[model samples]
Target chain A: MTEKVSIKRKVKCALLNILMYISCAVICLMLAGIAGYIIYRGAGGVTVDLIVNKPSLLKGTIGILPNILNTLYIIIMTLAISLPLGVGSAIYLNEYAKNKRVVRLIELATETLSGIPSIIYGLVGMLLFVQLFKLETSLIAGSLTLAIMTLPTIIRTTQESLKTVPGGYREGSLALGAGKWYMIRTTVLPSCIDGVVTGCILSIGRIVGESAALLFTAGMANEVLGIFEFFKPKMSGSSLTVALYMYAKERGEFEIAFAIALILLALTFIINALSKLAAAKLKGKGSGR
Target chain B: MKRAANFLEKAMNVIFTFCGFIAIAFVVLVTVFLLVSGIPAIKEIGIFNFLFGRVWASTAQSPSYGILPFILTSVYGTVGAVLIGVPLGLLCAIFTAKMAPKGLGTVIRNAVDLLSGIPSVVYGLIGMILIVPFVREAFNLPDGANLFSAIIVLAVMILPTVISVSETAIRSVPREYEEASLALGATKTETVFKIIVPAAKSGILTGIVLGIGRSIGEAMAVMMVSGNVANMPSLFKSVRFLTTAVASEMSYSSGLQRQALFSVALVLFVFILIINLILNLVVKKDVK
Candidate 1:
């Protein structure tokens, strides 16, 4: 049965429809404006010399080579140390944990970890790494702080993929006289490579964008370091975001800041794309269609 | 040989169990560190005076250690952000979830992802360049970096989460419910707003709570555009959030000042913990 709509109802529906479209348009326009404006201003400032050179006081020049290396050093150090721990924890929770209560507790702790702010992570990193452990304000201290922050992300992703590994695979391997660890190594772990890759990409995104935590632990120095120097106790260097803050806020050099911002923006886009690819791959493998 | 294999298995089980507990250890370490460092400043200044006192002259002749201004600013900024962002985000979510064509929805979703991926400092930079000057000219104020600018920036910043979460929630609402509402002669828009939205209320609430957490914990962007003064919050007046208060003064601060910053952080942590607890309880209850 077709029912006649009241005039008031019609007007309200029209209004809501208009409001919804307008809201969507506004959001998209705002995003476009921000991205276009940043790229327009920042891209022109990005130069080869900016990428290859370090900031020099005597020459009145600025570069982000040191910042770039610092960022890479931190990411490599953090992922190297954290990947094993995070995946191990995920395996424990998904495959080995006996009691439900213990699983819940660990999950709760992970949730709490994820919810805590980065600035507090900064403070605790300062107290524990710099003060208690006597690592001082160095890149290693900063990267360890980031490792903790990204642990939940890694564990959650790995555990999710571990869950999707078919039980039949495990049983089949056991029937073939393979031990439990052997079964996992041969069948379960390899299936979740995309999950680990996604976790790594996500963590890299976080480590690249992080500033406050690094500001406290990784002191702001623009000197480029040799690879071996990264592990030295008192070595300090700023990541890209920290360098951006220093250039824009502290040094009042918007040109250099915007150039750095351009690099960061590009990095973010690449990271976002990589994560999407990894997630899509995982989903495809999980469905097994 | 069998005994050695048994020992290897047992050792690995112990190792994995220890790894599982590492997160708990980290949380405990963080909490204990904050408590050990944070308590001294509060102890130095009476709890009442520290929390509720209006003045915050940390570098004065006789420095005062009150954090009311910071607390108020953070609360007001978060509330303001939520009020402005939630409606727009909700409307956008509904549009994308139900109204938009497939290609358009994907584009909007990608845009939203890109928005979230941009760092907070970049947001602050954009706000400083654009919003700050606009506010100053529009209001004829000497300084535009104030609570209002921070709220505006925060509103934009939180939109990605609100849009994505609410869209997921709304999409998850059973299609049968909406079909039933439409079958009852209700308009499409009516079914969406009245039926789908109500069913997805808990998820929307969770998004809002998460937004509030983001706004409260935000320091770098807020510090840039908030004109970090110790003033009590007013819409157009300079203010300091609990976060910026710590970040702005942590460099070169000494004695009671440093301790007080820790105290402020502790208070902020308590606020975050409460928010987290509330989110967990509500989500759990709703699930049950």
Candidate 2:
């Protein structure tokens, strides 16, 4: 009886180990398959011409220069607006807020915002920015929408980093007669730069991958908007993801779609690397503090 | 001079306070806008009919708009994705957190991060070409872009969140518990599944809930693969989720149809709220 029980236990343990190893292999293989297939299929179509020129019916050329630049513009606009609001909120929550209940309420709101899907953000952006604010379906409106969507990410990351900043730094700054805002600016915020960078990278990842929110807020016009043309009437264009959607779904242009996919995959790789570096830096700093 | 300095500080405080209020204000604004825009159609069409009636021929002359198909599709897709994703993700999490060598772990972690960073549309595009065809050939069906294809794509889309969250949870399990189990002659595998995982139950639950939210809210990926028809969900049948139901029509929908799309969004919103509330409870426990 004792021998049989031990054997049964051995079998169960072996099966569990197999389960663990198989799951790991499955995950790793899935990743390998996706990366290999996308690169092989997509890289062939990513030509210099596709990267540099814009589509023109007369010339019959398809390019994504405008989409790439528009992506940068949206990134700049979203970060400009959301970073301040999110960081300030984080500061208020972690450093300055007097009422615990108010802090909890704000935290809950931000959590809800993080979980709310981008489609709803798209609709709200359409209603609020495009219609109510009278901004057309332009990059400006799209950026504002993305800014709202990314706020929770920035705030949460910043709050986390703020929490890691030692209390001694703030108390020391205060002991030297620094005011609250001054102490935060000089002492608290500096240590949390890596957290802010991580947040920015995460938000950029979301923005780069985003399509549903921008579709309604930023109409799919592929023309490049100049500096002066921004915030003017009808300065609308597709980002790379949205362009990929239009190419594959609307235009039946698989070559161009694959080209865009290749670019996006590269961007994803870069962003993931940067975020990991930022996270590692944060960990090192956090432990030292 | 001192009064002026104090006044400046107070003004700065007020500005930061206003900035902090911005998030709460946006939430209120979205909820109010969704309610204001979404209710009129429900009142016009009757709530019961809108939520539960079977057919959804929006462009037909008669134009019946029951969303039973969409709601069920969303629910079933989320459930299916969770069923496939959770176990695979849990095992992978255990491997990464406790078993893998340091070098292998970093590589696997990076791969998972890359998978997470890929855009939903890219996933959709790949699925449209690859999985759709594979499904068609495997099932010997005329079309392969059905609920099943969408579920597969969603499962992959959700893997990173599951793996990352559960890995964190499992890693945080007290080492002492595992040590005690091993001291008593329990195998490492038994100590992990039977002891460590049970201790991290709440965290793993939160991760699964987060995946459900993601699967239900996914639009572009599901849209590309799932045939954009309002059919009740079956494993092999083409179906439209609530998200796709709104997205496929929102671009050119007019008058009552447009309002009805908002109503669809409202339903999706409520489903998300319930999920968010549960997620909050789980995460709150983890924090404590």
Candidate 3:
């Protein structure tokens, strides 16, 4: 009887482990299925001219080059605004803030901002950047709106990364007569580079994926809107996700929509994979250094 | 020289201290902006009517700010998503944290990371093609898009966040608790449910709150699957949500109608903000 019970226990544990393995496999299969199908539908239209030329509603003439450029423009502009402000806010939250209540309030605010619906951010952008500031529906407005949307994520991630750095590093730098600001610049920031980079990459990924916020703030004109056209209303452009959404909503052009989706998915996957690679390399270097 | 350096240091501290308050200032300013734009519309609609009215017709002349219908629909959608998402997520978490083989855990984690990385819009597209069609055929419904469709797509979207958070929480529960339970003649299933789950309740709660926020604010995907009709709530029938209402109509709206849409956003903002604050407090207490 004792031997039988012991065997039964072993079998149960083994079955539990098996259950875990199966669930993992199933989840991966489902997610990968989405990526695979999008790529499958999109692969036939992968041509150089298709990638570089202007988008045409004609049967097979939908290239994403201009849309890609718009995505890049949005990303750069968003990072330009968000990085300085996010890092600065994180620095204050981690290093300079004294009152616990103040810190908590800031935390609350950031969390709340992160949770705000993207459409709300779009409305705010429409009201503030477009109507109030008279920036119009330009790339600048889109980027700035996205910058606000991404800011909470950046600040939270950066603060958490900064907090992970040992207090001893700060103490040692201070003891050496370095000013707190100097110490943060030289020691704290340098040590927290890996964490900060990961945060930035994640934020970039988010900006690239964002749509609803940009839909209103940045009008979905497929023109080659240059960065210098920020002051003009004519240079409004849309990011890849928004472009995909527009294409899909256009309805009749199923192939064009599918192709754009494929490209968008590919872009998303590549960016995410690159970020993962950067994170891994940075982690390795940090440990090795 | 030491005195001069001390003075510089003090000044630098003061500067950085002020910088910290800027973050607080950003929050306050944004809140003020929302309130400034939203208050008049709220007043016009009447606070009670806005909160409880069953219909949502926010035209320029006879604007009805009754968010009560959308609020109920949002709740139904979120609850449906949670019911599906939380269990699947918890099971996935259990598998990864306790069951998977050494390399399998890494594979599953990476898969989840990739899933989380997929934009919500893409998820919307996938749902439009796959789940909507499947549900339409299976239920023989008139419209493919409805609350049920929204819930399923959201369930999948929230799955990654839930799994990752719940996994972390469950993993953090000391192994000894499980070991003790097992040593006392308990099965693995019994131990996980009775010992492990209870211990990780706070972490699981945090994940639930995060999922709730994600679902509440979700626009792109839900906008696609939800029928985008502002009417009485039915699982099979089409409905509109606060996020959907804002996204669908913001383009043509002007003057008071636009302001009314902004007011809808403010309502969502308030709900999510309250949830976030409660979550942070719960986390802080749990940490303590």
True contacts kept of each: 0.60, 0.75, 0.60
Candidate 3: tens digits of C-alpha lDDT, residues A54-172 = 77667546667778888888888888888777877888889988898989888777776777778878888888888888888888899888888888877876786787688999999
CAPRI docking class of candidate 2: medium
Please give the range of 10 consecutive residues that has the lowest summed lDDT in model 1 chain B: B1-10
Of candidates 3 and 2, the better by TM-score: 2
Clashes of each: 0, 0, 0
Which model is ahead, 1 or 3, in terms of DockQ? 1
Candidate 3's C-alpha lDDT?
0.81
Model 3 chain A scores worst on lDDT over the 10 consecutive residues at: A225-234
Q: What global local distance difference test value does model 1 have?
A: 0.90
CAPRI verdict on model 3? medium
Off by over 4 Å in 2: A1-5, B286-288
| Candidate 3 TM-score versus the reference | 0.91
Candidate 2 achieves a global lDDT of 0.91
**Candidate 2 C-alpha lDDT tens digits along A57-175:** 99998899889988988999999999999998888888878899999999899989999989999999998998898898999999999999999999999999999998999999999
Give lDDT: candidate 3, residue A41.
Answer: 74
* Model 1: fnat (fraction of native contacts): 0.60
The local lDDT score (0 to 100) that residue A287 gets in candidate 3 is 61
> Rank order by DockQ, top first?
2, 1, 3
Chain A accuracy of model 1 expressed as TM-score = 0.97
